[model samples]
Target: MTQLKTLFFAVTTAALAGCAATPRKYDDESSRALNLARAGGVYDQDLRDSPDGTRSYRKGLFTTLLDVASLATSFDAPLRHLSGTQTFMFNATDIMATPDNPSARPSLIGWMPGSLAANQDDAYEHYVTVVDEAITHAAESMSITATKLTDVKTPEIDEHPLMLWSVTSERYDCGKSNCIIAYNIQQPTYWKTPSYVTGREAASYNIAANHPEEYSRLIFRQSGDERTFPVGEFYSAVSADMPPWIVMYFPPNTVFQDGEPLTYPVLYEQGQQLMFKEPNHE
Candidate 1:
């Protein structure tokens, strides 16, 4: 009995000593910041199970670790890089309208003299050219075929305007072992109304108009052995009335960094907190 007690005490002491020997440390301020950023108890909820009947807790943990490592090293570190060719589709829809009654022309409350050149006509024309160039550039850069820009139809001045674009690209590269495809769409504010007339309202309007450009870097990744793994989709309607919409979809098991998989829950949680809120979006 004495020998058994001694053996148990020895084992417990060794375990405690082992735990004390492995001290947790942060290399720098950036590492500490990253740790704090991800440790906000936001991801404490149960992770949604993947289609393969596996939970992605490990993937989430690894992603947090990779984020910390990236911050410690370089902020410009590429989220992902593929050596083989990739394909993407780009589609945009815009509704054009002109006031039929001269007296009922849309009123411009805050039009400045210097910005007159960017009137509705000029804005529409520029939007067309810019979207066209953007699609062409994306296709060329990703080495994929894209559908020609589709101009659906024009509406009357009183009718609500709509602008939406979608892209779908699929290909296998990197020694033909891995396959990847990305789809993204944006629906910008396309209507003019007097509801945004107050100073605060106008300011909010301008910010919402420009939100997409600011939040475009939010990317999600998933991984799978077969290229045909299920794709994950995310969409947001910022406001109920005349709200801007953004949608993105990608295959499962997509990784932003080596060995770090991006999951839907992580992206959705981050996006909901960041994009749809007050201070963050403002």
Candidate 2:
């Protein structure tokens, strides 16, 4: 939905607290929660959708941390009733390491009937995911690999299983004007490389040098030098439940405004990973 539409929904929903005459006070807390709920829909979708979101994820848009209270206070709802690491934690039994076996190709965790029995007392001890051998392989594909360390630094979350991977020092140019792109990295967190580099920096001297507007990638590698993800050549191979789609590559350079292209640059690739985004709100 466009911003205007979302605003309309929020305003309408917010206004409903009024009875025939008096209205409930809108609180800052509730308004804040509503905003979070809205933002959560957008970011969470980035991780779960193919190029677009499934209906379950979409249906969740209107729901927030609280319903009546949010309206009473005009606060954005919390993303969940459960807060802290609990929301980030996934059942340990349901997750596993990638490359099921190094000797065999990796696949997501399989269905096991007895894994978590009802009323099982020991079920809540911990949550876990096997380390990313897939991303390890992906890193190797691009000739970037981490050194052996005593501890692996992973993004902490309510985790079933997590995988994070992206290219380092990579350069891609999207000429689209005021373009907003979506991308997903299986790993838990990403760090943009090339210390202090920004989207404008890439646009000024990197692959996008010829085009202008604004474009950027997130959690890019930290290397001072530029590298390409070679994502176009890589595939998940394992995520059976893969979203309907994933971002592939950004077109060389193109800019758009008002749903129209303003400037253009030729690209061998059509655009950065294809995205199924909601219509822009005016």
Candidate 3:
């Protein structure tokens, strides 16, 4: 935990000092062509699972002592060593809609899930279903008809007002603990690839619009007999380039004392509370 905090501090300092590089400029024709070429797949596996990896700790005297105690008593190994480091995997899909066209409608690409742990597949699927419902509801809030994309791949939306909807989710099991944490995030980016380029300078080279960007995460921990709530800001518009919808149903920075089914309302609350806790959250 101390190491994690130190790493977070370093990253925050770098970002605050303007260490990020500027994006290279592309010609108008090239920009449009590049975006279209990259947007073919229903699922961008690389983007969805950006920081997908594992982190482990070197055994120390404290952990060694605990291991010995576990062998002599009925108590199990400490939770930190048993499931301290986490390996995260995500499943994501895309949807496209042409809201500007009077006769146009929304269409989902096929549900192509990435790799996930075998033990957590069932829970992950349930969580995906809940998120799918949320995405559909979000579209309806914007006044559009939505449909699940099945038995299909990329859809053709080259020359139209496009809105791409995407979602990703993960589930974490709290062994011998009171709460289970489910992590999920969605960033919906769209380009108005209309027949003509708008007069705006930025739009002259690329598509442009303002939309919500959001991330929803939940984490559970156990310390003695006390329950520990998660802390962080789950949703934010970090960049104007990527716009996500208002996925505020799940409140961030929350804890559930009882073992209840991880439903939408629960997620909504958890999502809202997570926003302020993690300064390093991307």
Best by TM-score: 1
Q: What lDDT would each prediction earn against the true structure? A: 0.25, 0.22, 0.24
Per-residue lDDT tens digits for candidate 2, residues 113-216, read: 22332322222121111123433454465454322222323332233213223223223321111011111222111111121211111111111111111111
Q: lDDT per residue, candidate 1, 1-282, as tens digits?
A: 999999997786555433322222332322221111122111122232233322323354434322322331231122134222211111011111111111111111111121323444453344334434544564455554434423433222223222223334464222221222221212223232222122222111111111111111112112233323222222111111111221121112332323443332222221131111112212
**Candidate 1's C-alpha lDDT?**
0.25
Total residue pair clashes for candidate 2: 57
Candidate scoring better on TM-score of 1 and 3: 1
Q: Model 3 over residues 1-282: C-alpha lDDT tens digits?
A: 999999997776444222111122333422222222112121111111111111111113223212211221222234334432221111111112112211011111111121221223442343345555554554344333334433223222322112223222212222332222222322222222222211212211121111111212222222323322221221211111111211222211122334221111111221232111112222
Candidate 3, which ten residues in sequence have the lowest lDDT sum? Answer: 48-57
Ranking by TM-score: 1, 2, 3
Which regions in candidate 3 have their CA more than 4 angstroms from the true location?
1-118, 154-282
**For every candidate, C-alpha RMSD to the true structure in Å:** 22.2, 21.6, 21.1
